[model samples]
Target: MSPAETALPDLVDSHCHLDFPDLVGELPEVIARARAAGVGRMVTICTRLKNEPAVRAIAEAHAPVFYAAGTHPMSAAEEPLATVGELVALARHPKFVGIGETGLDYHYTAESRAIQQVSLRLHIEAAQETGLPLIIHSRDADQDMEAILAEGMARKPYACVMHCFSSGPRLAEAALEMGFTLSISGIAAFPKSQELRDIFLRTPLDRLVLETDSPYLAPPPHRGKRNEPAYVAHTARALAPLFGLSLPEFAARTTANFDRLFPRAAGAQQAA
Candidate 1:
């Protein structure tokens, strides 16, 4: 095939924080780099309920960007608990594609576990009602996370993705069993992340997605520096081989998985 016909496949950064300080100020250039790297789409997550406007504005302003919002687990105790009604209202926006970056995070704010559980359940309800995927950010709270998610699903089924997943095998299994997808982040590309990578390797391809979680996990070469959507290619580069596919093939699958989970983004991309 001619090189023109063999172009690299486009990928989506399924979860990121474009509203964060490390990225919000330099969006134009950051987005430009992402496009140049074949990362043609992104989902910027809003961790605080108060900042949803700013986050929504980024999605509205950027054609390739969509957004999600919820009160983060770490701040669950500090912020007013997010209401299902509020989140359902937010999802009415054309560019609002997902429900949360919410889940438990006992690693830092274990004291807020009770409120976090309440917030997570509310987000779950919003997702269930609105038919939007829930973007979860879990850390060091695997057992409770599993229980709460399972309980919530039993109460009312909803779609979900374990964003930037680095939890244990049991949690992974639980999420997969619950029909939740797992997003591979730059953390999976770290030198010592073989265990995490192994877990991913065992996951079904259709249940996999990819993200930068940018301004956080930058992958190799750019490790320790502020991450951007462009760096997702590096994480893809590392993960694709393990899946027994070239970068383009893996990109295509993960991008398709992303579109399947976040249909609004797919619709917006199609409309664009």
Candidate 2:
């Protein structure tokens, strides 16, 4: 099938770094491209609490663009850990719909485990306070990630999403058991990512979210270039056959998942 004829659904790029260098300078064009490509909505994820004003500005600049507030696990070492009050306060903004891009990562040695945990806990507390979902990123620390999330979820009920999920089935099972949603990224579209695709196919659509993790992980045909929200269409195409759903159906289901997790977005969608 030609790239454009793959029959993309009205997908959502649930996680992206639109505020980063590649797209920030031309957000108008970037968003236009995404809209043209049938991306119905997107979440410009936050990697640092301190940069939230910038994040909010981007979200506020355009319709269907929402912001998330939290520090990335790798950024925890460079940025000050977010406190519960700070995170809660930031997330209270109307344009802010979630708390995270935070979780565990041992992929890089730049951050210590202690710092990541502290930040993760604060973000979780913020999610509890604001009733927003928590976005999580984990790598090579499944045991610690599971333990910390288990501990935090015990304190209060809160929504959580394992963003850019690349963990084993055990971690996936645990996260699902704790009521956390699992987001599949464009990595699933790669030839070597069959295992990831297998897991994604097995995952229930009700608890599944599709993300591009844009400015990175662009799916096939655009795999080597910096990704944008528009490329999320590629993920939906890649996912269709695996799940036995038509493209439009896949899009509708994932978009529904997005709305369910971010109630504020659901409200906005309804009002619009």
Choose the strongest candidate by TM-score: 1
Tell me model 1's lDDT, rounded to 2 decimals. 0.91
Q: List the candidates' TM-scores in order.
A: 0.97, 0.94
Worst 10 residues of 2 by lDDT: 263-272
> Can you tell me which runs of candidate 2 are displaced by over 4 Å?
1-8, 267-272
Off by over 4 Å in 1: 1-6, 270-272
- Show pairs that collide, candidate 1: none
**Which candidate has the top score in lDDT?**
1
Tell how far residue 264 is off in model 1, in angstroms: 0.4
Question: Could you give candidate 1's per-residue lDDT for residues 1-272 as a string of tens digits?
Answer: 76633785678999999999999999999998898888888999999989999999999898989999988899899898888899999999989999998999999999888899999989999999999999898999999999999999998889999999999999999999999999999999998999999999889999999999989989998999999999999999888889889888899899889889999888454222
Cα lDDT tens digits, model 2, 14-81, are: 99999999889988889888887888788999898778888898888788799897889988888987
Decoy 2 TM-score against native: 0.94
- Quantify all predictions' global Cα lDDT against the true fold: 0.91, 0.86
